[model samples]
Target: MHDSVWKFVCLRDLQVPAPCQVAFKWIKLYGSLADGSHSYKIRNNEKHIDWMRIGAFFFDSPVAILSEKLSLPLTILNKDNVEKALESSGACVLSNIKRGIWIADLQLVRCPVCELDTCEGTMQTLEVRNIELFLCDEYQKGSWDYELIGSYTINKSVDAASGGIFDLKHIKDRAMAGVFNLKSWAGKPSDMQPKAMITFHSVAIRTNLQENQGLITKYYAMRAGFEGEVVSIRISQQLA
Candidate 1:
């Protein structure tokens, strides 16, 4: 058995309302399972939540999106058919589409290379082990009401009495800026995808609470309809 099957699930239930004040925080987590860090100011909301891209990801150096579901969408996210138009414009391709936030083998990584069958130090050769049809946000023709919600912080409680999850005293007592992102871009022992959005979430877990708070809150807000209603978030984990 290994400890690599753990997953952090951030579920903002757009269909319901938050139960209490403690539960009504902008960012909330189930446990210390995700890396909620880094706050990203969203400029656009497409049919897909995308891989948390920045800069010229398409027209220039196609950066590899990190596979931290705690922060970025684990799979392809297409709420409508707006981002899909990128395919025709030669921006990207959405491969292995699925319902909701489910991706199919969409995790990208950086493979290294060397002339002597090895890579070392600053003289290393990094390679992007990408797919055939470079997946990107699609259906870019039908989305509106891109409102700006304030930053959300992933508030955690030290007192784990209620389902070992949340409490008020914890937030008031030991709440720091819980931001989850990458502890740098290098992946484990040998895989480096250079995905900046750790979503460890850096809108994610343990430390990434601040970042998680901001991004996930905006996502919840955008999906929950244009304000004026109770925005509810449901966070859980997956031991896959």
Candidate 2:
């Protein structure tokens, strides 16, 4: 993966470019459970909606404020059960997480694969199932807003049954209007690998920034006066 591409995506999305035109000092990762309570709550806690678990693969960031009351839907396997769980329990009120950092746009995709991991050829498949838009500017310190401009999804599984996370920048970019796509030069598929299961949680923003910290940093990643520029913005594991 070329560092320039990664930097470009990060900078472009934030509407800033590097002085040297080189994207540096940024890292990308697959959004996953943090283990312990975080993961456990989503799986076991039938009474909560963990919006944070949602992926951040966007083709384009919102150029305009799409919605004032960010209300994105989470794709749950047991829609009714999950809804019931949240209605009955308050232990995991995902909606309580800080909005500024905790807010993210979610897109759900399905990749069905063979149960056996011993399959031949590529054991990965992908497809876009749902496209959701979210906004959390109210939950943040300053006026923040982003929207799902466009998105795309491709099924590239040699084996129809080979399961994989259909999570990638290509799909995100297509879904978010090129706002978020994997750095093509990175030599990595823009899609996310599949997981056995997944869930999402949304937390409300607290007045205190520090209390609701670590939700989202990309917001600060780009600013007119910031050191670096947002050369390119494709939502994925990095911003998820």
Candidate 3:
């Protein structure tokens, strides 16, 4: 068992949807989720859909707007003429969309023994059951747009009966050894709630057998992101 780490980021309004309507958009313009064919391939091969949900500015430094070249180069093949190649090579275009800074809380859980041939093996996975966003007093007056742009679930193995026998004692020992830190990294109070809660179907952890211990640490680790819509919103008497 290991401790859970939390981080924070800022979210900007890329393209405002119609007032009071939520439009979920992909955080990255180019990804498996953006293409139907790629999504199908992932679902078929991996037995799960790999999609990332959240998108925001992750750095703490001041945001800067880099200058874009307005004129084309005279050379037929030059570094400046590689925009199309870059786009084709799966580069993301950072749009100059309306920007807003919203605090995002991230939680990461680490497991000690991710894989074992015996019943002692435990899967380390994080399932974001739901997300609640609590808007500030200013934004609480009127309805706002909420979108569930892109996300997916990965279920490695569902055959509970086929796995090794459940060991309650082993599980208890592991749980006791593990330290969970759900505290906010930004010094926010533990009781603080978000303005909205986004819920989705359960997404399980898909683990892969680690052959090269030198390269990977965990036995099973599925890297995915969560971006979803706000199905419901509740106003809190206390401000976040």
Candidate 4:
């Protein structure tokens, strides 16, 4: 097995310079169980979600914001993207995907892998399932504004699995995007909980596969920006 690959011999057969470019988003974790209560009182006690059964959230860094489902997007990449990622490593200089930094615009593909970090609880797995990514912007009450911008639906719904947790990032021209970094350990979970902390950071990415030279040409005409505009942006793991 190649050291660069994940040691999964199944990957030796993948075709390099595969087909297209795609992106992924993984959500498979909880933020806190403090929302629920276990103490039972005659009428005061009420049933809570299964997650509320846990003692407390355990982490050493500022926890990330979880989705409404009370889960964190852990991996977020397409299967094709992963395959392209493996292919790209052949001549890598500074990017090590397994270490979580990726080059922009990998390949066109769908399917996501999820990664988990510093967590505790009755661990469970679906063993088989499908993952997806959706783009959600601002929404107002009584207005339905949403779009399933991306997804990884497969003919065969199976486990989207990954081991351990690792920080991930995307880089281009030395600018970093899609970065996940945990805070320095204040101590062990057994010692004390994470303090409320904040880190100032910036995110930059190339949305269009094209150089977007059109914007420069239309700079004066579209200063207000194109209203009711629909753009399509594609990114993959092989892309850096």
lDDT of 1 by residue, 8-72 (tens): 12233221122222221123222211232111112222211223222101111111112113222
Q: How does candidate 3 score on lDDT?
A: 0.20
Best by lDDT: 2
TM-score of 2: 0.18
Model 4 agreement with the true structure over 1-240: per-residue lDDT tens digits? 233332122122211121122222211101011122111211112221121111111111211111101112233233334324422432111111111111111111212222333222111111100011112121112122222322221233222111111112221112112222222312333332211111121111111121211111000000111232211111112111
CA lDDT scores, all candidates in order: 0.20, 0.23, 0.20, 0.18
What is the overall TM-score of model 4 with all chains considered together? 0.18
Structural similarity to truth (TM-score) of each candidate: 0.18, 0.18, 0.19, 0.18
Query: TM-score of model 1 relative to the true fold?
Result: 0.18
Candidate 2 lDDT by residue in tens digits, 1-240: 675565556545433223322111333311111222231132223322223333322222112111101122233213555434433431111111111112132222121133343433121111111111111122123332222222222223221111112121112223322121213211223233322221121111111111211221111122212222121122221110
Report the error of model 4 at residue 184, Å.
9.0
Q: After superposition, how far is residue 22 of candidate 3 from its true place, in Å?
A: 23
Task: Write one digit per residue (lDDT tens) for candidate 3, span 126-165.
Answer: 2211111222121233233322221222233221100011
Instruction: After superposing candidate 1 on the true structure, give the runs of residues whose Cα lies further than 4 Å from its correct spot.
Output: 1-145, 150-191, 194-220, 223-227, 230-240
Better of 1 and 2 by TM-score: 1
> What is the clash count for each candidate, in the order shown?
48, 70, 18, 18
lDDT of 2: 0.23
Clashes of 1: 48
